[model samples]
Target: MKKIKLLKIFLPNSLEETYSKILNNPFKIGAPNGFEPIKISESYACAKFIEEVISKELIIDPFGNTEEVTSKRYIINEFTISRIRNDHILILENPSRSVRELIRKLSEILGTRFYASAIQIDIHALSEFLSNNRDSIHLKNTRALLSGVNLDKGSSATIEITSLKDAIHDARYHFKGKTFKIERARFTASSGTKKSTIEVRSTGLISVHGPDEKSLVELINMFIAEGLS
Candidate 1:
């Protein structure tokens, strides 16, 4: 499995303005080669959109009733973009092909003229695989589990980052050597100052485990400033 997320930075704008632009001048973004153009909007989760709008052939039964699409779609190289909240949320989930092209398209549509932030790249490694091939990836500075299935056990590293794009670039570079299938990767754009925003994004993954809120914020800052190197 593979995940791709992008965070587009911009000066503060009203939700109304953002919403109006999306509704009036809708834009199409890059997607997996055979997939449809990435749709940008202010409503609908990825799964719901697929079930209601995309072809039935493209939709598959989710692993759980919780709305998560099954992993089978990965083989076909599909992708989805979730609803965006202009203040600080732009999500691209399960981009199975042409990650670079997709990002470029998004950058063009979103307009880089607005100060954009680093692209955050997140990849989840199957715990079992990490256990079997510890030497493949360098997550040496292990910390306590922050999020994910086994909250008490899963661990990750605090790879510093100067920007999300560079960090993700470096992550992809390392991901090549590990050979472990990626479970998820996300790109986020935000003011990291917002607790609600961060919480919404950290719904999964054993994130940077810190001793306290201040420390956790520091870790996120480091991540956005430098790619996990």
Candidate 2:
């Protein structure tokens, strides 16, 4: 699964100047490659994905290099930062721990400190959406893992759905006489006769396992407007 990170960049008031700085200076290093910006429409001015080459000091080569000496090794931290015609939210493709430096560089280029956070989607709302739109979306979420504080005891529990896929759309599994609210779920969605699947996690990572561009866009829009805080 491809893990993408979403960031809400706080740009300086001079939006035009910020773009000019990014277009010219571009916190990017090395030669141009596939991450280069392309024109989509007039809604967006410029978009560029960055691949950073960083070198780390290796105490000893783990790949059979002689342990007698330390050397500098290079690695590529790749991620695409697309404005996507949306200034409020910045999409980071395949984010990793090293991506924090990329975010810092961007904030420096913008001359402002932008905060980063995982785009946490409300689990309950998402399940509600899927359950209501059953005509276009056919999916199932089993083994809902719930974690919360009740009274004075904090607990996490996992429950299973014993019914068929068609009957598991209730959002929460009922056991005995209590309904357990699901706090985390993996939604696998595909339209009628389509083989591709779109996966949305409650942890705020939106990954598309298929080539459903239309659905991806729709989901992103919904996420941008309602997902991030």
Candidate 3:
């Protein structure tokens, strides 16, 4: 009979329960280097059991935003099965900035109760594919498809004045350049200061940011309502 030394298994679910069950079996022994030596059948069983356990608990939301949740689940499973592999490494990839922060916070939260194995977050590697193809046609096409309507060439103008009174006046009805139907414009006072800013952008297409959120929102709404006029 050929001796199978190492077994690789991919489990979509919980690894903790699987590891515990494997450890309790009589035939397996914990090696000094951290891996547990087991018969091939037992190793296969552990992997299968992990998959079944995970399938039951995992759920996909309607929005299809489960990447973060799935990555963490895999990490947890790997940590629980650390002793099963001689050198266990859990490599997580392509997590968002917020997700990365959450993982660190979770590690700290679970620090005392259950020790997690060495976890490596490889963000750079995951994004490496995008880095190499920065100028690809596919990327350009994709961006164009998702971008809002082009409002750059439409009738628009910007005037900078020293006084807020002048700025608001110009934004309202002073300039008669193109008369592309004034959508909306807003003026906002600078916080903790005397200066202010104004912006007016067209509706469902472009947005102009000013000194405050209120100005931005109002301008956007106005652009939508008046742009059609």
Candidate 4:
């Protein structure tokens, strides 16, 4: 299934500030054919359009010779800013420098800060997803298993399990009403770092395990950065 992840753009102030800057001030940006302003409201501001840009691709001939070809491509994207409680969330496809650039322009115009970051999934959502798909995660669970499923404080420990799948014959426990945290994840060099088992449900619930902490943070960034694949 196609994964859908809404990237996070941190605004310097709350949603109310956005209203005074753009929504309240009311201004247009870019050419009429590019970055068109769609709508603004008391609740949210939405803008979306297709953008065409030049891109390059590699071609392999039957003789095993390789060549680079350049062409034009269109990018479809949407951006919405709204107040979810107290936080101002920038909903957009991430790692797209174009989008970030647009935000940068807006920042310069409004004198605010908008930062593109990789920390998308919050701790609670990840904790819930891991609770259910403990066996299906991408992290090195063998270490956690070998380290033992249960432990008390005040002791140094190191445990190892061959693999999460291999632990099918292992034990099960009832961990209801408990809180879990995701701190680290990694794949062995032998296994490589490519991960493909993540599923983003239709409801927009995404649960993706990672090869490492940095990889997980760059999940959405890599999605578009390597979109040619």
Q: Model 4: which residue pairs collide?
A: 146-159, 146-160, 147-159, 186-211
**Each prediction's TM-score against the native?**
0.27, 0.65, 0.17, 0.39
Q: Could you give the candidate ranking by TM-score, starting with the highest? A: 2, 4, 1, 3
lDDT of 2: 0.51
For every candidate, C-alpha RMSD to the true structure in Å: 16.5, 5.4, 23.9, 12.9
lDDT of 4 by residue, 70-136 (tens): 9866555666665444444555533244554455555764565666544333323332344344344
Better of 1 and 2 by TM-score: 2
Off by over 4 Å in 4: 1-3, 7-33, 56-70, 93-109, 118-229
**Candidate 1 error regions (>4 Å):** 1-8, 26-87, 99-112, 119-229
lDDT of 2 by residue, 1-229 (tens): 4555555666564445555665665433454321344333333334554554445453546676744443342333343333434455556555555666566756666666655565666655765665575567666554344443132245535543333352235433334334454445555566766634444555555665655545654565454655543
| Candidate that beats the other on TM-score, 2 or 4, i.e. the better one | 2
What are the lDDT scores of the predictions, listed in order? Answer: 0.34, 0.51, 0.28, 0.44
How do these models rank on lDDT, best leading? 2, 4, 1, 3
TM-score of 1: 0.27
Candidate 3 per-residue lDDT, tens place, 148-190, comes to 2233575334333333333323432443333323333333334
Which ranges of candidate 3 are over 4 A from the true structure? 1-164, 171-180, 183-186, 191-198, 205-229
**Quick one: how many clashes does candidate 1 have?**
16
The lDDT of model 4 is: 0.44
Candidate 3 achieves a global lDDT of 0.28
